[model samples]
Target: MTLDDLFSAAREAMAKTHSPYSKFPVGAAILTEDGRVFTGANIEVVSFPEGWCAETTALGHYVMGGGGRITDICVTAERLDECTPCGGCRQRLAEFAPPDARVHLTDQAGITKTITMVDLLPLGFKTEILST
Candidate 1:
């Protein structure tokens, strides 16, 4: 799917965010190489550390659906400037998305920028590390 389409999915998922604590709703949409799309919204718990990021949730949904090889992912939030995935989420994405996979950042004004996952998380830890 196109980046715009993925952004739209992210927006839709954002509407379902259960962030009663922070009220900083976030959403993510992951497009697999096989053309499957999985959307997720941030879920927060009373304990801050227990909260799940939108990207991580989306990745989990994709895996649960038997999807693999993320080709692109879009993230959106009210504050566009802070919509980028966190360090933990970035590492989680690196587990599935290739270095060249597209990472799109979206906001109320629409997509802000599109960069490769490598640009976001250089020197990511991959399976090769475990094999070694």
Candidate 2:
């Protein structure tokens, strides 16, 4: 899928964000290697820690749909340049997306920049990192 399409999906998902607490709505869309796209919005809970991030939610949707090998990802929030994934989300994404997979960050204005998964998490842990 094109970056424009991915960003559009993310924007649409952002409209469904349930961030009553922080009001910091965010959205994410992931493109599978098979050309399928999955989108998700951030959901906040009263418990605070129960809040779910957009990236994680998108990944869950992808997995539930039997998708594999994410080829690209787009994230949108109040500010495009500032919509980078958190450390935990970065690691989670690394589990599914290859190091060379593109990650687009965008907002209402437009796409801010694109970076590879490895650029987001240079030292992501892998199964091989754990010696038997």
Q: Which candidate gets the maximum TM-score versus the true structure?
A: 1
* Whole-model lDDT per candidate: 0.89, 0.89
Report the lDDT tens digits of candidate 2 across residue range 46-109. Answer: 9986999999999999989997888899999964455899899999899888999999987686
Model 2 compared with the native: what TM-score? 0.92
Error of 1 at 6 (Å): 0.8
Deviation in Å, model 1, residue 85 alpha carbon: 0.3
Q: In candidate 1, list every pair of residues with a backbone clash.
A: none
lDDT for 43 (candidate 2): 94
TM-scores of all candidate predictions against the true structure: 0.93, 0.92
**Over the full model, what C-alpha lDDT does candidate 1 score relative to the true structure?**
0.89
